[model samples]
Target chain A: MIKWVDVYKAFGEKKVLDGFTLDVHEGEAVVIIGYSGAGKSVAIKHVVGLLEPDRGTVEVDDNDVPTLPRKELYELRAHIGYVFQFAALFDSMTIGDNVAMGLRKRGEMSESDIAHRVAEALELVDLPDVQHQYPAELSGGMRKRVGIARAVALRPKYILYDEPTTGLDPVTSAVIDELMIRMREKLGVTSVVITHDMRSAYRVGSRIAMLYDGRVRQVGTVEEIQHTKDPIVRQFIEGRATLEGDAASLAAPGPAFESGATARGGGAE
Target chain B: MNVIEATGRWVRFRVEEAGRAGRFLEEAALAFGSVRSWLPNATLQMRRLGVDSLPIGLLIAVFTGIVLALLASYSFTGAVPLYFVGTLVEKTITLELAPVLTGLALAGRVGANIAAELGTMRVTEQVDALETLAYDPDSYLVVPRVVAGTIMFPLIVGVAMIVGLGAGWLASIGLLHLSSDEFLKGARMFFSTFDVEYGLVKAGSFGFAVTLIGCYKGLRARGGAEGVGNAATQAVVYSAVMILVLDAFWAMTWLHGRS
Candidate 1:
């Protein structure tokens, strides 16, 4: 389980996450939906200790992520797979080598065993027989799949997807959404997908959390979020411009939604 | 901003940059503790940095040698002995020209390439991906390039020295009508092993400076394509400037002190 408790983070003077809190239990997909700069990616990054919260705690399986020692942090990271938005494939390396990098670093597997596992992971992603190809040679969707293959090659306990379907076509986005669902069910791994695509959230998420201002505005099942009564949530769900009074309230923001907004929000449960 | 405020900001920026450089050095030192893991990458980088650079180094050395010999001959018309042209060419090429010129040339070639490659990776988040995969970026990305540079720089300089001398000798004998024996004697007259050692030291130091600055600029690159381009340009410019500064330091400290 991952828990972000009263997290506060900022860059220079801009507070990106203020008293932001969320929890993801084991073996479930929780997709965090927010605007482009809403800090959804920042929230998931804390779970893997990629970014430390300035004033709160991020715990994974009860291990304090930010304060963990370097060795322990690496050990923690070994169990968490992070898929970058751009695939982040090493251009110089072949697809096979990219997939095999994590296993190779562990230094316990034989060359043939690593090769076999690379093949298996690629096959799981339905990207068989493209190992020798470089990332530049692959299509954008294929590269994203290769990125997923690389992440799952380690058989991590948790997979963090950062806008996995952002730039892909709708059909390709559906493919990625399906892959996320399949990976969760097939591997029984927890997933935290950070995306603004509501369709993707509905398709792959076991529960959807909407991050607004700085905190989670609402979190519940897809239907529950869709039927939410909160004006902010309703406006966001319908992709409508905020109504006059709603805009005024949201625009006057100095961390407008206070801490514990999640608790008071009816849709949170 | 007021002049004082502007000056304060500049000072702060320099201090922060120095701190970052110090941190980079610390990380690079730690990377050496895991040197065994980076050997394969080091070997590949050595081939790329050293072997591929040889032809270019040789080309520069040969042309500079030929030009030196021709210019020295023009000044040899008076009481100055024609044989002295050989000594002048040999000393300048071996002690200064070969190593410094080769380093400057590579600062543009290899340094820019390293920065551009790593900068692109940074912008694309490949380096972050390495961190996420539990791989140390310093060991995987930096150590190999630095180690390769330190090892290859001296070898490239040695090649440059030999080729430069050979080209000078040929130019002296063929173009200037100087006898082989006279030219050879003049070349060997004032030669000292210390000069070779000085060149090697300079070469190694310049190599490290070029690669480290390149990697530093590349890793720190932000924004996007424009930032990557700027990093590559800065790598070349900084490496060239550092190479010249190191050259002057070596000349003042080592050569002058010894003489």
Candidate 2:
């Protein structure tokens, strides 16, 4: 399980996360939906110790992520897979090498075994016969699939996806949605995904959480989020412009999502 | 008050940058413990940064040699003997020009290459991906480039010196109408082993500083393409400045009493 407790992070007078809290249980997919710059990515980065919180603790399993020693943190990271928003493939390396990089770092597998695993991961993502190709040679969607393949090849217990379908076409988005579902079904891997794509959220998420004013405003099953009465959640999920009296409120920027917002049983999961 | 505020901000920024660089250096030094992780990568970096840079180094050396020979002949027309052309060319090339010029040239090429490549990787999140894979990016990315630069700078400078001397010898014979024996005699007259040692030390220091600054700027690059471009520019500029500084440092430290 991954737990972020009352995390408060700020950068030069701009607070990105304010009392932000969430938890991911095993064997389920939790999708975080929010506006741009709402600290969705920042919240997820805390899980991998990429960003340390100013006044909170991020726990992976029972281990405190922020306080873990360097060797321990690296050991903890080995069990988690993180898929970047941009695929983040190594431009200089071949697709096969990118997929095999993590396994090679562990230095426990034989060369043939690593090759076999790389090929298997690529096959799982439906990318075959492209191992020799560089990332720059691949299409954006294909590069994303390779990114997924790279993460899945590690067989990590948890996978974190950062805007997995942000830039892809609708058909490509559906393909990725299916891949996320397949990973859950086949490997039973726990996942935490950040996306603004409502269709993707409804499809892949077992539970959905909406972030507002740097904190989760509502979190529930898909049905609860879809039928939410909260005007902020409704405006966001329906892709509306602004809430009632929101234009003036946005100018002054007071506390947001405070009224008519339901935290649904007062729990993140 | 406004001027004071701006000056304070600039000073704070430089202090923060110095702190970051110090931390990065400490981490890089720690990464040297993992020899297996960086050795192969260092070998690849050496070939890419050093061997492949030979043509440009030689090209700069050739032109510099010809210019030095011509200038020496022009200056030594009257009371000064023509053989001093070879002596001047030899001393200048070996003691100063070969290391400083070659360093500045490679600083532009090697420093910019390291910065641009690593900056692209940073902006694209490849470095983050490396971390996710449980790899220390300092060991994998920084150590190899720095190792390559430190080991190869002196070697490239040595080769450039030889090529430069040969070019000067040819120019003295062809353009200055001086005998080969006179040129060789003048060249050997004022030569000292310390000159060559000082030049190589400067070259090695240049190599280390250039690549270190490149890696420092590159890894810290944020945003997108513009950030990468800025990092590359800073890498080259800082490297050139650092080379000149190190040159003066070595000259004072090594040549203070002897001269």
Candidate 3:
């Protein structure tokens, strides 16, 4: 289980996360959807021990992630897999070498075992033939697949995906979504996917959380989220938040009353 | 007044940068509590920073040796007694060529590669990924490069010195018709172990300067493609300039020590 308790993050003067809390139950696949700076990325970072909260605790399996000792923390992280937005493939190494990197760090795996596991991970991602190719030689989609292979190669119990489908075509997006679903079903992995694509969220999310203004606006099952009567949730899900008087009010700047008047004016009749 | 303030600001900045570097290493130690893993990371990074760099470093080493020989022979022709031959040759390579050429060669090779890799990782958010994974990016990234530069630099300079000596010997004996024994004897008298040590120390320091600057610039890189290009260029240019300034300071200090 992963839990965020009243997390607060600020960079200089800008508050990126403010007293946010969300719990992802064991075996749950939660997809976080939000605007770019809405702090969805920051929120997941807390889950995996990336960024600690200023005044809150991030617990992974009831153990405080941020406060864990270095040795304990690295051990805890060994069970988690993170895929970067750009795939974050080591450009200098061959595909097999990149896949073997994390395992090699653990310092117990034999060369043959590393090779066998890398091959298996790549096979799971449908990229078995790309083991020898460098990242520069592969297409973007292929590179992301290799990234996924590397992440899964570690056999992590928890997998965190940061914008896995961004910049990918719809077909590629669907492929990744299926892979995400398949991993949870096959490996029983607890997954957290942070993305802005509502379609992806709907496809992979058992529980969908929408982050707004550095807080989780709502977290629920896909059916509950889609059919909810909440205006903010509806506006966001439909990609028509621009029509909200709230959005207009926020986007426009002035004294509160004048901005309210403009927001009201801008709203659809 | 502004100029004085600016100069003061520059000095203060260097001091702060040094302090930050110290703190960064301390945090890195905390992050990498396992000395076992840390050593391997350093070794893997060292191999990449050194062995991978050998081919390119050797190319510069060879050419730099040949150039020193050629230039000195040309300029010193008929102007000085032949007994001065080894003194000039030894001083040129030991004091200047070994260290300068090593830095120059790496500015084009290791420095550029470090900037490019770090810059790309920065842009792609890989370093951020490492941090998110609870790994200190500086430890995983910069420490290895620093170690490689510090260790491999001396080795690289040694190669440059040997090649330079051989090339100078050939140019003097084979090309310039100088007596082989006199040229060889001049070298034996003027070449001291201390000179080589001085050159090696200079190489190590220069290596640290270039790698840190390259890694720092790269780790902080933003914007996009143009940003990375700018970073690579700045790393090379600044490292080269710092190498000269540091070389001059070392020279004055060494000269003082001898006197």
Candidate 4:
């Protein structure tokens, strides 16, 4: 249903993706796993036509996404829902309005019909009675639920999740994982989840693709990935492993170390 | 902390925002310059700011016409020759009241609106959403405002000129016992093509500055309610300040060119 063929993308002098290609079958749940800045987000952004590949084509339902007219592109996008990281709910709106935004923009549905669908979407995300509340008033976990509800409000055939559980507590993350499983079971919709949370990826992904340095290192079932003894993969899975050689090299980059170590140069509160 | 020191901090933050506003304008102008891809957004922006602003702009013109006449009658009562009242009415309405009042009207109606819309867009990620949707948000959001300002400023100025002239005629005929024909002749006596051209130039420049500053503040709006409030305040402040400065500049150049 989706394909990225020989894609190349760059920002100024830095090449992010070079000749990257991938395919996702119909109704398949594909999870993209990678470390930060590994181009996981960029890859999904291509699938949705949010970012166009410079050299190659992205196809949704066999139609070249970048070449589609504005109306056609919007129509195609209507079938694919997106849940952004940080929820990105409209802070100016109530939860109900946020979910209703997609439907209202279509301008074909009646007010009553939109209201009913919004309620249904919220219910699907296990959120009830929170429609009247603003996004700023909700907990982070609850806001993610609103984001999920809004993404699914259009009854899209596909949904994309970008780092869904990154900022959540462990328990909340587990809850979100369960919800993802139930959504696939209940809706039978195709899902593309970009995540670093291994447990969540395992729970939700029918097939997992591990992206490293802007290319797919491996794509297989959860067992295939988990059991693979590839040293680089295993080391990353072991959580931030550093070989003696890596430590020596990282240590030897003196200016780099000193720059990173400056506490005063770090993020402000 | 002492009260004075706390107030000083507040003042510093305000000063910082003024600096931020200047930076936002520069960035927005640069971003809007990249309209090679997205042209429709500029039109949509026109619909929102310029076309939408017409009704209230007209209302303001009409009211100002009547008020200008009423105020002028008081000042001219027995202080000047009665026959000169008709010409004075025409000159004041044509030369000053029409263009200036129309601008003031827009400052309230269109100015407040662009600020709020842009401010809301700033906080809601709608601006970023536009970028994600592959449309250049600034060009879409701003260029329309500029176009609308250009189109509507002159239109409102025209409306104000006509109504103000008519109101002045009524006042002169009713109060000063001058005939309509006499008043119109004297009003037309001072009406040079140069004066008309100069007023249009002022209107065009004023309108552009108002819309540009208004939209820029909105798109760059931050924080929550406080941020929006600041954008609104700044929109009005910057627009008003720019208007006075530009008016002075135009007046100097116009007089110099004519003389």
Mind giving the per-residue lDDT tens digits that candidate 1 earns over A157-181? 9999999999899999998998899
Task: Candidate 2: list runs displaced more than 4 Å.
Answer: A244-269
Candidate 1 — what's its lDDT?
A: 0.89
Q: Write the per-residue lDDT of candidate 3 for residues A102-187, one digit (tens) a residue.
A: 88877779999999999999998888898888999998888888888888888888999989999999999999999999989988
lDDT of 4 by residue, B6-33 (tens): 9999999999978986776675566655
User: lDDT tens string, model 4, A88-140?
Assistant: 78776799988887787676799999999999989987897999999999999
DockQ of structure 1: 0.67
Better of 1 and 3 by DockQ: 1
Mind giving the per-residue lDDT tens digits that candidate 2 earns over A137-162?
99999999999999999999999999
Please give, as one word, the docking class of candidate 3: acceptable
- The C-alpha stretches of model 3 lying farther than 4 A from their native spots are A244-269, B1-19, B27-80, B130-139, B174-176, B252-255
List candidate 4 segments past 4 Å from native: A241-269, B1-124, B128-259
Candidate 4's DockQ is 0.13
Model 3: how far is B56 from its true place, Å? 6.2
lDDT of 2 by residue, B1-259 (tens): 9999999999999999899999999999999899998998999999999999888889988999989999998887767998988899889999999999999999999999999999999999999999999999999999999999998999999999989988999998998888999999889999888778888888999999999999999999988999999999999999999998888898787778886
* lDDT (0 to 1) per candidate: 0.89, 0.91, 0.79, 0.74
Report clash pairs, candidate 3: B65-B164
TM-score quality measure for candidate 3: 0.83
Name the regions of candidate 1 deviating beyond 4 angstroms.
A244-269
Candidate 1 collision pairs = none
